[model samples]
Target: MSRFTTQLAAGLLLAPALLAASAVQAHETGDIIVRAGVVAVDPQENSGNVYVGGANTGLEVGVDSNTQLGITGTFMLTDHLGVGVLGATPFKHDIQLKGVGRFASIKHLPPTVTLQYYPMDKSSVLQPFVGAGLNYTTFFSEDLSSAAEGLGFSDLSLDDSWGYALEAGLDYKLTEQVYLNATVWYADIETTATFRTASVPSKVDVEINPMIYMASVGYKF
Candidate 1:
């Protein structure tokens, strides 16, 4: 978690100012642009009120951020329009229970496909764009901590989620075929979790709305 925090802080400090950099060239129609960089996932989670033994109980849930290798590919259908796909190495998040401590962890993959529109023409040096898309998140490898295990927590699982994604980005042309890119994305994700305790099964709803950030060098072909 500390490592993730450090990386995210570093990116926050570096990217925004660079977004205003001047461009030298821009991509054209029929071009394929590929980019690679470090990506961060910061979850803004809101948990449902937990109920046990048929009685309402208060519980708080939180998620820690993670950074991973990020990659994206965009295919230009026209000088001003493109289709893009975003991907990354799986992200793992630590799930902490308020007052109770870190109780579990989960891994997930969010793949998104978006339609992007560039405001500048191919002759311009700077390209600023906006995009909208669909995001599908799949969760796996859910595990309970030793403390949770001791408390009879087992068979933990989380349901998959499908949601909408929105994005904005800037590309500063470095050369005719290369550029620097910075992008930010938001996704709506909500899921339900279920687990077994010594006495009975328990459930809770978790909303993991996340903000994702990326900065990468891109190549056009």
Candidate 2:
């Protein structure tokens, strides 16, 4: 497994310990919770072979990790059910061409909406929830590195992606209105990268299924 994957697994494994250290509390209906903190985007990416002039290049690509400011708000419809919106600053990732060094860079925004279900009752201090939702990602501000341009690459563009997202999170209440939150989400994202090499525009299919992690402080009102 990759280092990021291992770290994510470790974080999830420590959830029970987190619960053990905090009081159990449940959210009530008509409550609004707002959270803000840092979020990391780690893409477990895969790509098809690149082509140039209708010839296979036998090269694969990968994406590097990025962290950005994350903000979210949740409104409780019932004690156990809530609707939430997740947002973040644009995430920037370096597109690495394996063995051939850095290739390009891209920035994207992933906005998500989900329905969350909390399993505990109102008196509990630690809230653990599961959510399923939709993720819409838009790619922009693509740039080709100097090296890539030197290699005859230009006119790069990445297609927008719309996919499903799954989330698991835990909230530990520190006071009546304050809490610490830890959450992880996985999004199924796919895109087609089109660029010109030697004046020939070529396309590559890429799957950038990313796992997002967030740790934040929240307020309930």
Candidate 3:
């Protein structure tokens, strides 16, 4: 398994042990929770063949995963319900082509909003939640590799996407006002990449359904 997966598994295994200690009041109405930590975006992509001037090139597109700083905020509406927003620093991904190395790079931000449901009671130290949300992703800073440029590619761009997202997470209270948290999200993200090659317009449809993971420390007020 990958290092991140191993670490996440370890955290899940340790959560029960940590929850055995003394407990504190979990989220209450009017409470606000803020968290920050590392987040990774792993794309499970299905890419269409590159079309150069309406001709299929048979080259498949791929995107590499990236890790970035993640921040989240939640406001409790009741003891068991909250609204949350997730943010992160721009994630940079390498765009690769089949039979070719990295051909381009792009940066994007995914901001998500969710209605979260906490299933545990207020006195529980281990709080597990599930959420469903919408995600808006904006892509920018698209740059072609030198090799791609040399091959007469230019003006690369990616369209922004709006998609649905699902989340599952756990929070282990360490104190009345602090906690350790781990969350995972799946987002449906699709975009059309457009560029010019040999001065002819080319486009490719890419479905980047990504799983996002975050391990964070949270504070409540």
Q: Candidates' lDDT values, in order?
A: 0.88, 0.92, 0.95
Cα displacement (angstroms), candidate 3, residue 36, comes to 0.6
Per-model TM values vs. the true structure: 0.86, 0.87, 0.89
Question: Model 3 over residues 1-221: C-alpha lDDT tens digits?
Answer: 99999999999999987875545578989999999999999999999999999999999899999999999999999999999999999999999977887889999999999999998898888999999999999999999999999999999999999999999999999889999999999999999999999999999999999999999999999
Candidate 1 lDDT (Cα, 0 to 1):
0.88
Which scores higher on TM-score, 1 or 3? 3
Give lDDT tens digits, candidate 1, residues 118-190: 9887778788999999999999999899998997778888999999999999988888788899999999999
Runs in model 3 lying further than 4 Å from the true structure: 1-23
The positional error of residue 53 in candidate 2, measured at the CA in angstroms, is 3.5
Q: Model 1, which residues run further than 4 Å from truth?
A: 1-25
On a 0 to 100 scale, what is the lDDT of residue 198 in model 1? 74
